[model samples]
Target: MDVGLLFDLRNPAQWHRPWADHYARTLELCEEADQRGAGGLWFTEHHLFEDGYLPQPLTFAAAVAARTRRARIGTSVVLPALHNPVDLAEQAALVDLVSGGRLELGLGAGYRLPEYQLFGADFQRRFAGTERNIREILRLWEEKAVTPLPIQDPPPVWGGFYGPRGARIAGRLGIGLLHISHAMFGHYREGLAEGGHDPRSARVSDLLPIILAEDPEAAWHRVAPHLAHQVNSYRQGSVEGTGRSTPLLTAEDLRDPNAQDTRGLLDILTPEDAAVRIRELTKDLPVRHLIFWASIAGMPDDLVTENIRLVTEKLPPLLR
Candidate 1:
């Protein structure tokens, strides 16, 4: 599996920087990571957040493509139900073309009721509609319905779902699945068989939320508050979808890294330990790219810079 970077470009209010500076710093980091042999650069999307989560990942991805030459550029997850298929297909095609065919399109049936309400999408029927929209997006690309077709015969697509139903959709459609646990992948293989596809023809792209450092404890000391901010924002951000009112998480709420409260699960590891963790996570799996966050919720500049260096320069040799 190749090592990659994930960016959300979140700027929480309490830890916020100037918006332009946030974007510029992230783009510069992407460029540096790309040059330093990071295998992939992935972006994710969310909207209407207090932290200003990235709303248009493709827009930022296009910028990454222009700045990089070797690394694959992609969306780890973008909500298809909230977009028009033909338009999204056209945009994806353009980005793929600009990136010289390095695009991995990941689709998701988002659960955020607030996001759906903002987009005027049907929240209850999001699964069915999202599946349909994703298929249409693929069809448009295959049929050359959009100008400037993608450079690859067709760039790979992934279903960003963590459940059995979504696994089946991905398998039936003969696409990649983003989530993979041993149990979940059993369902994926079953779906492949049900869809009359070869069971061995499976692919994966997933996240490994880690901070690799020579000193793990010191890294955690610097990373805890940002992790707290991250966990709290997601909790607050999904209240409408989950119907759960979660009080904001504080550093006290996250004193134990193993606690359920800090579900963001940021692991601070030395490079050697991280490689071993990556192995344990993906043993006997068909993983294409295993990614780590390039920055946390506006982490300190030095910490972000150090993590980037470790991800690109230090971790690769250990994995090999």
Candidate 2:
């Protein structure tokens, strides 16, 4: 399995620190991770979130490309429904050129209603729009000629799918597939079968919340608030056609707040509990690439580095 790191660029606490410091630390992490043999560094895109979520992932990717020589740079997802397809294609092509063809584009139909409203896009037809945009982007990158042409062949494309229809579309288009953490092994396998393709032939990846720490209590204390943020955001509301939005996960929502829970779960795991959860999650799944979204609300930079070190050092041995 190819191990990758995912950054959401969230500014959880209004900690009194220079923005440049954060960016510098992130670059430090990227360089260190590359030296440690990480396969890639993935970024996320979000708009109008006061939480310091990145609004321009391509720009960030360009910066990353300039700083790091070996690690692949990618967006965990760019919301296709919110972008003009041609412009996005041009930007993506430019980033690919800048990175010497090391670009993995992850496209999504979008899910947050507020984001759609902010973009003035109709939430109902987002999937259709996303599909159309993907087709247009492919054409623009592969067929259409531009003023400054791309340096290499078109960048590899990965379509993020939450349901069967999107998966089928990806299969038809011969694009890579990105599955979520929940029950995606079964869904991805079934989708490949339905598309009349061997599961082994499909290029697939998955993203999940992961942390590796020696002390369970310390890790949970650092990560729980951020976890709560994600769960709350999804539960507040979810767009239709987005598969299985997170249920309400407030502190009150926990049946046993003190209990360390892992029953009936597929991908999520506590750091000290289930070391083999990663293997189990990917066992029957056709995931050659695995990206871990690695941040908890108030996790310190040192702890984050340690978490990355543990995954990079410990997980690869297990896989071998």
Candidate 3:
């Protein structure tokens, strides 16, 4: 179980300080995590969310690569539906070279309707566009003399899948798989098998919210509102396009639930009681890596460091 860190570039009220301070602290956290023997850093991409989220993952990843010495840098999921494949390929390749080949590219279809509208992209064709863009990106990386030649070897790419079709595509393409939270867990293994991929040979990773504290009660107070807001954001976003109501969950829902709510399923552990639940939720899964989104709701740098130390120092030895 390799461990990694996830940064959402949250624009929370608590972090209303200057952007430079947040950026500097983020770099420090990455370096600290690297020194503590963490595996990687995963950054997310979003647009038009005044909530202080980043819209450009490749640019952010490039900065991370320049600052960190050993930890691999990755995009949790870049929306290929909204990007030009050629430019993405070039930028990703340049970052790969800068990092000495330590890049993990996770590509995904655009999901948020606002982002689609803002970018002037047709939301309906997102899946198809994502598939085509990924194919072109692979071609640009694997083939030589692609009009504008890249600077280094092709970086390893991963398909970010939230459904069965995307999972199948990942296996067929022979790229890695990134499962966000727990939405696809039940069908992921079968999807890989259906695509004629051996489960053991598949490189599957997941990103989840995490926090570690000496006092569970105190941690809950700090992280609960943020976790609730995150869940609400997904639910609100899902309702506009899908015409479905997002279901809420109780504590009992985590253990056993009759309804299959995607948000409920994915928010597997609420921050109010995450430490113990996270340990249990990860067991028995083919988790190649566990990436912690520690900057949720703009947590303080010290808290982020404590969470990373908890995973890298305290958790792994027990798992072994």
Q: After superposition, how far is residue 291 of candidate 3 from its true place, in Å?
A: 0.7
Strongest candidate by TM-score: 1
Go through the candidates in order and give each one's C-alpha lDDT.
0.86, 0.70, 0.71
Candidate 2 residue-wise lDDT, 78-144, digit = tens: 9888988888888888887887877888888867777887888988898888878887888876776
Q: Rank the candidates by lDDT, best first.
A: 1, 3, 2
Inter-residue clash pairs, candidate 2: none
**lDDT (Cα, tens digit) per residue for candidate 1, span 1-320:** 78889999999787889999989989999999998999999999898887888999999999989999989887879999999999889888888999999998888987688999999999899889888999898899888888878898789899898899999888887788888577788888887888888988999878787887778888788888888888877777778566679788777677665776565467888889998988888889998887899888988888888888899899999888
Give the clashing residue pairs of candidate 1, or none.
Answer: none
Q: After the best TM-score superposition of candidate 1, give how far the Cα of residue 233 lies from its true spot, in angstroms.
A: 0.7
Ranking by TM-score: 1, 2, 3
RMSD of each: 1.5, 4.2, 4.3
Winner on TM-score between 1 and 3 is 1
Candidate 3 stretches greater than 4 Å from native: 146-153, 180-200, 239-286
lDDT for residue 11 in candidate 3, whole number 0-100:
65
Candidate 3 lDDT over 31-116, as tens digits, reads: 77888877888888887665678778889888888887878888988998898888888888877877778888888885788788
Quickly count the clashes in candidate 3.
Answer: 0
- Would you estimate the TM-scores of all the predictions? 0.96, 0.83, 0.82
Task: Report backbone clashes per prediction.
Answer: 0, 0, 0
